[model samples]
Target: MEHCELPRRPGRLDRLRQALPRLFPFLGWWPQVNRRTFKADLWAGLTGAVIVLPQGVAFAAIAGLPPEYGLYAAMVPVVVAALFGSSFHLISGPTTTASLVIFANVSQLAAPGTAEYLHLVLALTLLAGVVKLGLGLARLGGMVNFVSHSVVTGFMAGAAILIATSQLGHFFGLALPRGGSFLETWGALLGQLSAANPWVVAVGAATLACAVVIRRINPRAPALLLAMVAGSLLSLALDGPAHGIALVGALPASLPPLSLPWFDLDTLRTLVPGAVAVAMLGLAEAVSIARAVATRSGQAIDNSQEFIGQGLANIVGSFFSAYATSGSFTRTGVNYDAGGKTPLAAVFSSGFLAAILLLVAPLTAYLPIASMAGVILLVAAGLISVPAIRHIVRTDRGEAGVLAATFLATLFVELQFAIYAGVILSLLLYLRRTSHPHFITLAPDPASPHRALVNIRRSPQAECPQLKILRLDGSIFFGAVNHIAEELHRIVAQSPEQCHILILGSGINFIDAGGCHMLFHEAGAMKLSGREIFFCSLKSEVMELLRRGGCLARIGAGNVFKDKSTAISGIVARLDPERCACCHLRVFDECRARPGGEDVE
Candidate 1:
């Protein structure tokens, strides 16, 4: 019978071709465009524009910016990201987290909504864009993975609570204090519960109820927009004599004008930290969302390209008087559900959003701030992934600890500090786990077993009186040298009769200077004890380490064997022959070949 050879997989060149979109990201999804897809994208864009109407203004308010800046962020950034990004459906715009981070970082430097504040925000956006662009070019997209999923889950949950709590004043039309910690805000809310406006609360409650009902019964329905309209109409109807509900008032009807970010050194310095925080959080959010959506769509995502896309979005958006922007989880999900089939959908959304701004600008006057607060409340609720939290707590204690720490830290400490804490903790835990490698002593099984089967961890088999065999299963790095040396010393001390030690070196992948020193010390101790150390199946890398450390000369080249059987035969021949002569049991074939050798059988 003839045997057929299996075909080899594609080479690196082929893979490179697939990943080449790292340079020109739009190419990643532009191929999906067709007439049918174009139509789908158009409709999806329409839906996105309508959705962003309330979201843009609300997010601007969160960032302490004028409502128009939020709309500006939604427009240019969305178009830039879609055109240059890897994902087909990811829509970039102002997000709640990014907004809050901006406020937290820049609020101390300048008064919110002032010219100085606006200039600093623009500089921040520009700086963030530059950083993101550099990372993409350097192909550092993988670094985002260091921000663990558990940390993200916890941070989002905490941010959600903060978002909801921040909106309490708007929700009830109460004059609660602002700009403090979550606990302080809660305290203020509790203290001012009696000052709440019943009329505003009624409007908020009605909007919230309508949105919830519409979402449950018909997810595709424009529930938020519908809720806003209902709230506005209700406010108008109740405006006759006694109702004291407040509204957003009239908004300017115009396109975002071209603007340059302020270039003052003080402003740049002030915005630098905020820019870095925005860059990290924004890129993490965008890449994560793009990868997730791509997984469901069976499409490959180019992380580097996504980074470039986000960078370009922010860079372009800054000139358009926009603040920091990133991928919106809610908006992206909505786009996918609305049948978006290509990047063009996001572009269309931006265009339609600009067009809608003209007609909807006047309607802003009747849209109650209380109703918008209710929408924010809904967003806050959506951010908390209860199932994910429960799973982390139940499955992994280490990850659960990280989650808890991150959540509490985010609530009390600053946003950037919280992220840094989580990242640092994660790295520390990883290093601690890898610093002590597992070392085991292996011995051949004798009772009707497979060839050379060995017991791990613990075994009752008595080792050969003259030879000791040990197995190491990790890299011999600087961090692990002390632990490995201690284990070897303990084993040698316990079994003094086993003078000659042979190490199974196949599992060792790397060795550092500290590890080399440890090996040298062990070889010297063995030499003093009238014993020898040998290596069987030693890898080339391990041999190099020993040779460089001058330990190989002490161990002797003749004692090292490339094959296990050959090493065993050599060791048996060198064993104390007088002891073998007096032994009743012969464990090796070489024992029988000796002049006075005898077998019990």
Candidate 2:
């Protein structure tokens, strides 16, 4: 027996229930919770918390803030992101990239490790969060797609190099001046090499060696945490500070303290540009990484929701003494690999990080600055994606050029402008490629038994005396309109006797005002010269655009044909019988069927 399914009408309550999940995204997954997932999340959360301990401190140092702020950032923002963002595996925290960007943009206005600097950092975070929230609300998450892969790869490589270079002073125990350009920093470091302390270098080297060995032995090992532990122990054994080695000092233990960001107009003005940069970069990085992880985990992600999550995290985190926080690629990958089952893992990690800090805050007194430098150097090293660079260089010259330019600009120029340069170059090159679209002449294929059209360049077929067949293979936007017009003019110039033109319109995807105006003028000129223009296989969208622009009326609806065979028959019926009879080309069956033309099919 066959059964008919009836459409069920949703009541107001049912509709409201469905809308709840969209508004509060966590509700979608909360009902599916099980013991197995809870256990997995517990383990994943513990792993992530341990991992963030050293990282938070290192990233905080990079951002020119005190050590405790990094942990604070890792806590509040991370939980907020987990509760609100779409990605189950993404862990928001004090990332190396975000920290580096913050320092680069803010260091010029205030001294590092000072009251004024902290205030600026807080304000900057707030502004960036506001910007991000606005963008998410406006549903502009698709903007990240415009930032090309080459640009990101190049920018990351440059940022990595800068990260490593910046840490050279701490690693080598040199009192190098901060806030200098890349070259200037290098120059200052070289000038102060004689003043380098051997004990500090040994501490950094030991940390670096431990991390490398752990990673080589087992890639899944928490190499950073292990290295930091080893370095801190070594520092304690040697009494590092007695030998002129700097230490991170003890961080404050307990919950995040609530504080308002400075709202001075002059300070806000100074931070606006950097805030915008951070907001854009953070969103792009988060969305890209979220999508990438979702590919493996088989999870769906909403970019706009992710943007809002990140924005709220930073906005709320600013009040809790956290600087700008974003999605950390390294931690997110670790979280996924560690069997994190849901956003609960990230939420638990954030909560666990705060609790762990309270218990182990004093232990940081043994963690030398050199050890932090070593960890950051490793981070910088990881950012340089060798495979990505090699692939770009070996595969595409255009993208390689973009990569080279972006990479160079990132190293030597203002980092924000480097992103712009890459995006602009990508667009310009794309337009250049599309503007000069392929305009190939078609002829009947002699190789095929059927009368099929093929490019004249590849086939042995003759052109008809009174007809011209052309193929266009791109959009008819304003940028391409001139070239298309020139090609059309050239076709008429080459074959003046063939007054009727039939264009294969299947390849044309779009037609704008400029394209319509050009077509109108061409059609009018052809009509005046006692000729006609026809379009074969024109798509519905192009037809609609033409109709709306009044080009279809001028050209006549009867001139457009659905298929090439029908178009050929229609054009053949209109061709002069005398010309067809005298023609020896025999390109069409109608010509062959005429009196003088050879009857070849």
Candidate 3:
């Protein structure tokens, strides 16, 4: 054997190129980071940390988990999502919608705040992560487009109402039965209004009023965090525990502790359906928020990569005592406003959150539940977009119907069912519209110098006595084939003497197998009945499909024409000689050379 070394071992650069897709995206940004950007990221991170403390507790309360779990969610998941995700400003953590869904689903199976409830929530996080990762890897980023914006707005509006409803008892200091329906929850509140603890109600009201006033004073200030601090100090002044007010306990640890998601077969089976709903909703939220922020930053977002980042965040977070999370619209806007330059801003945010928690965790022992409720109530209110709702309702009846249906379903039925209902309804309406494509009859116009095909009804032009020309103005798939066939049959039945048929297929954008089979069979039937059928201006893609389906051969390739002029001339040559002689309408230039040989006066 020749002593030639088996092709020189691949260099690091060559190996790196081969492994590009598998590598973390943050590696590419490392070179872009500099001192000024690092300083900007640190300040942005600090702002994010302050913003999340109140939010984390509020969201956790909504999710039926301990207050600390919310803080934990903002930790590892935020870092992982930023490092792997495509958006520079997107910050991932627990969100209002996700939290509400978690409480709605898991609370049905186990008591809120119980160990069993935590396990179910963790399982859902794990399963949802797996599904999200699969969708990303499969490159189904465009799948989210199927979810209409109207449906999303309606669903969120409904969730927002539910969130506000769920917080009423805490805000009012009344102990409410968990998992009650919306109407039932309100009914219960009505009966217990007089029993609310005055001290707790005062704390909640003052916190809410303070947040509002502070926002008005300085739009960019830490209104949520400052209002919460004010509420905590007020509670201390009112002797909160002595006044029968409940406090969110101090966190057990500042660090995200190691944990394992519930992997029990029974638990996984139970949570699978909910996990799917959570994954889809979270993915939609993350992608939409990312793209919206990208518009401001002039950054191009990779939707599939975002899906992968979200999946990994939730998956990794599940093992570190965090719940399912998605990109935060509010936090991302804040990051962009604060001039964050890179994904490192998000990484710094989580780090700062952990460091700050060490100093503030013990202070939470004085943080009233009512104060968290007030902040959450504000968030819930923001979720409902009245202007957007009005726009949808005014501009589109179909979209309005979807919004109403989803909103009602979310309030009355289970949250996941609401998503399914909206999707199915929209799809059904779409199918109904597509199944009945326009079947326009066309004729050659006499007014034009060069004969032009125009709608018969529009121009009132004469058509050949022995040939019926039609233009199908839509795709012909399984759904529309029957409608098309019935229309053709009706036209034929009405004009039995018109034995020759020509289809102008320029308007047929697509034709599936069912469409091809339909044309083939119709051609065979016409041939059997001593008639002929022809098609002209068929698109190349449609022609190729017909050819591949063996339809073109069965229908006779000779009968397929390239243009209206050619098709008219060829079909005219085949028309009954006696009919052509008797016919007065010499509608085509080719027809003038035949029996009806004069141009229109």
Number of the predicted model whose TM-score against the real structure is largest: 2
Clashing pairs in 3: none
Query: What is candidate 1's TM-score against the reference?
Result: 0.81
Candidate 3, residue 454: CA error in Å? 3.3
> Model 1, 1-601: lDDT tens per residue?
9999899898999888877775566775678688888887887787677667767887998899998899899888898888888788788999877998988887888899998888888888999999888888788887867778777777767767876887788888887775678888888888989888999998988888887888789876666667767877778887811566777766667788898986778777767877888998899778766765664577777788778889988998899998899988767866776678888889899888777677776766677878777766785676677888999999989889888998898899876566667777878777776777766777655553433626545555645667787878888888988888888888888988888888888788888788888888888887888988888887898888888888778778888898666787888888888777777545445557643575544
Q: Rate the local accuracy (lDDT) of all candidates.
A: 0.79, 0.84, 0.84
lDDT score, candidate 3: 0.84
In the predicted model 1, the residue pairs found to clash are none
Per-model clash counts, in order, read 0, 0, 0
RMSD of 2: 4.3
In candidate 3, stretches whose alpha carbon ends up further than 4 angstroms from where it belongs are 1-22, 27-67, 87-91, 95-131, 170-175, 192-249, 260-301, 323-345, 363-375, 386-391, 394-396, 445-451, 456-464, 529-531, 572-599
For model 3, how big is the CA root-mean-square deviation? 5.7
Worst 10 residues of 1 by lDDT: 444-453
> What's each prediction's TM-score?
0.81, 0.83, 0.78
Q: Worst lDDT window (10 residues) for model 2? A: 592-601
Which of the two candidates, 1 or 3, achieves a greater lDDT against the reference?
Answer: 3
Candidate numbers, best TM-score first, in rank order = 2, 1, 3
TM-score, cand. 2 vs. native: 0.83
